[model samples]
Target: MIIADNETAIDYLYYETVAKTVVKLIRQKSKEPLTIGLHGDWGAGKSSTLLMIESAFKGQTDTLCVRFNGWLFEGYDDAKSVLIETIVAALLKERSGIAKVADKAWDVLKAVNWMKAARTAGSLAFTMATGIPGPDLIQGIGSIASKVISDPKAYLTGDVFNKVMDGAAEHFKEAAPSETTPQRMHAFREDFEELLERAKVDRLIVLIDDLDRCLPQTAIATLEAIRLFLFVPNAAFVIAADEGMIEYAVRNHFPDLPAATGPTSYARNYLEKLIQVPFRMPSLGASETLVYLTLLLYLASGVSDSSVEFKSLLEVARKALQRPWLGTGFDRDKIKARLGSIPSDLDAALQLAAEITPILTEGAHGNPRQIKRFVNTMALRVEIASERGFQDDIKQSVLAKLMLAERFAPELFNAIARDASADGSKTISILERKVTSKGGKDADDDPMADWPNIEWVKRWAAITPPLNGIDLRPYVFVSRDRRTSAGIGVAGGPVEAMIERLATSTLGITQVTKAEAAALTPEDANRVFQGLVTKIDQTEDLGKRPPAAEGLARLCGDRPELREPLVAFLGRLPVSKIGGWVVSGWGVAVEGPQAQEFAELVGEWATQTSNKPLSVVASLQLNPKSKRK
Candidate 1:
């Protein structure tokens, strides 16, 4: 039931409208060369939109469309050469029936090949004259030269050396000695334009995608190649990339350019000059996200996009998206009316979509790819629980609620996990109250006063099917893998050595070891602390105090600065998974100003309804006088 992350021709996000507009613009300006920039953030569906534009040009005999992904040619010596070659190849294939067109295409290809050879021959000359191989020499030879260039001695050997010299000589003999670079470039463009005229191509629309995924060098090179055909009649280029990345590439390619030589930045000017028409992909709004999610969930349920049922749903969703501010897109009645009847699975999917949309919208920032990923992850988790035989226990709404926290507010999620675990009850009592009731109350009067003052929390709390008394251990258990730990891993030397001693069993860590752990530099101590926290997080059972706990206690006892962080670490541990050993082990670690904080924590543990043993121990710790004689 996984939704694929690849770019598709599906008009799920209404990008087809944008594509159609772009195609119309190209047609209106088909007589002149046109360069259009399709700008969007990664995963914002730039690639998919490009596909829509290409699809729009299908069956237009007068117009030819060719697709090229710059990322595929990332490591090539010259991205410009490959791009030119690609366009020529596409032209040749398209006009294969015209014999004269083939000859003209071959001539253009020959010019590209000569340009490649010139680069190689120049590199060979530089290496022989300077007794040092240039970077261009290695790049010019391609994969075979790259492999042996590291060992210059091996590069000078028999067949490989002969091959390089022979290729350079052949290209040099065929090259036009009197032609300067600018003149050659002009001639190549003239030849290409003549070829287009001969082939009767009204407009050669080359769709360039994934330029943002390429290296700065490759990205800039591809843009440079497009500039060669910038003025050639009947040539139109539609480039899809993140504008920011391309700007960064421009800055990188020309490091000496001033930050701003005019009203616009240098990089901005470069892109503005090259890309005449720019279309920025819009981020999905809340209503659009809801409609998108519903359609995706339907697809996940085995509803094929090609089916009449799916098409009908898509039409409704598109209409709703057109005016999202009116209401949440596609209510149940509307769906049922359109489809005649809603399957139970689809009804459940709709319910789930509604349940998660509010938080998912804000969390995923309305990116289609991100929303799709979240859906895929949620569906996979449900399948996993079903396979593990606890499917019935894991409700979709509950899991969705927890996942919202997991994805957006990880610290909050960890806090909830600790609260749920404190008494082995698996329920979060802090969220039991209605969100609206918290308003107008004094800070001290509100139970949620201790929670972060973020708006998303309120929205999440107001979501239907409150988590109040629901046992969430099964859901939490299924989601353990998604948990993030604060540990930075072991820093080598004394810090690493200290972790080893502290990680040992109680009997293994002697008083001398505790003294050594306490004397560590604050930086080293924090590192050791983080390492221990990571170890405890990975430990399968919190039923007993982990061996690292004592070392953490001793380290914090000496370093008061770590007390707040230590309390935070303790607060994140699942209480239900822990045992009575946690109630009294801190000793002097919680002394001084932090003692009240620790005491308050213990008092909360004592009042929790879950984990009787832990509650009893915590209760006794707070009131030793009440202990049995």
Candidate 2:
């Protein structure tokens, strides 16, 4: 299922209640401007709540709602200037006839540009009107004069220098009449209020979202901009961010605060000064999560949330949830009536929601986006498997149940996968017998009685969509966790068994099956090395070529006695894999005598063919340390 990872069209979390409260607060006819902080952690639906507040002013002519996402315009030199320009432009766009307001807004932009130029010219700009150059200014002038005289053709009469001088002169002249920073900010406020009056807006609500995602500088700049609007009448600012993150930004931006008044104190004081009112979005509960998952699944199944019938059904669910005793259980018949015949996928999603809600709620820490992400990840896995003609034999619930174990009970799940890898049919037989056997004398005498200790494992084994008598290799393969790939159907043979042990074992330099590598005699090592070479040769994707070579390298790196075996392995390899390995840095793993022997083998092969590239790479790999010098 793929619901859009954005604000919900329906109020799944009842955040509209919070949004309404915010709208009511902003709508109040206060004499002074107000700042309300909508604080929540990342993905706690702060953006969605902001959207809901914007919706509250949809058709109202008296209230002008504007949203600014600080993260969208990040990396700018001055976030405060960007905010000032963007707000003025939006206001002018709303009412185009206000020429006086537009002119004043243009002056704000010009003043900001003048200040930027003044900063660039450095301390000399302070004495531009005194008609006497300071030492630094004289030094700058002398450097230019020397450059012009020393290289007249290269530097004299160059338009670039003249343009730079002209620009600096213009800024110096313009800045003499430019208003001070305080005077300009006051003027901006007056112009802003005039524009609001001209537009006939009773209240201006500015919703700033995603402030927490910005860096320290940008976050502080946005906060400072809000302080400018905090005193203007009939204006309100709602900033959505995590309070903790904002505090962290404050601490980082102002790092040199005195220890007695420290970063924490400054951060708290800054937050209090800016955000006078704070509202936090509560985390989702079990019932709420189930309903949310069901709705999301329904939407993903192509149901239109904006349809009158769907909205009515959603309202009914919301009303039922508000009742303490009735709970979140919706009337199935009513929903079915509105939706027509329920799609089987939707039906399954609803059922899966009921089964997985509690586990998902706990695992996700009551976060809605986390639950959505979990479902999206599962659906993508299933979709990809189906595309590859794999896992078509399994049901969705089986996948969900397996994922539950993988996500929440990781150790238990990995153990099950390993057990299946060691022996699939035998493991399945044992589990089936243990789960199905009646509690008689045989059950009491069962030797593996205490196995599978995790609560979720027991629950999984007992759930429907029975897994008895099935080879779990496909399920484990679909999981896509590389560590669990060992459990995915190993063909029985000494060579294959050796390969599995080598590939799955995490040890030695390459971290590949150390015990197996240590156990091999020269002859067995030769056979196993040939087996890895054969596997790499048969593999079509070159991406899968490195691990086998790495395993061989680690084997030889740890036990140099296997150098002769590595020679045989290298002699049999296709020149392409060798060249690819050498160029791709897999040669670095081949150390000691193994590196020398492998390089000699490649050198011999290169001589027998016309592959000059292989010859060059072989020489480099043989004397790899020469490149370091």
The most accurate candidate by TM-score is 1
Query: Cα lDDT for residue 284, model 2?
Result: 80
The clash tally of candidate 1 reads 6
For each candidate, give its TM-score against the true structure. 0.70, 0.63
C-alpha lDDT of candidate 2 relative to the true structure:
0.62
Q: How would you encode candidate 2's per-residue C-alpha lDDT over 302-322 as one tens digit per residue?
A: 568886655765765676557
Indicate which candidate wins on lDDT.
Answer: 1
For model 1, residues 240-266, the per-residue Cα lDDT tens digits are: 998767866765565555545433556
The deviation in Å at residue 201 for candidate 2 is 3.1
Q: How many clashes in each structure? A: 6, 0
Model 2 alpha-carbon miss at residue 438, Å: 14
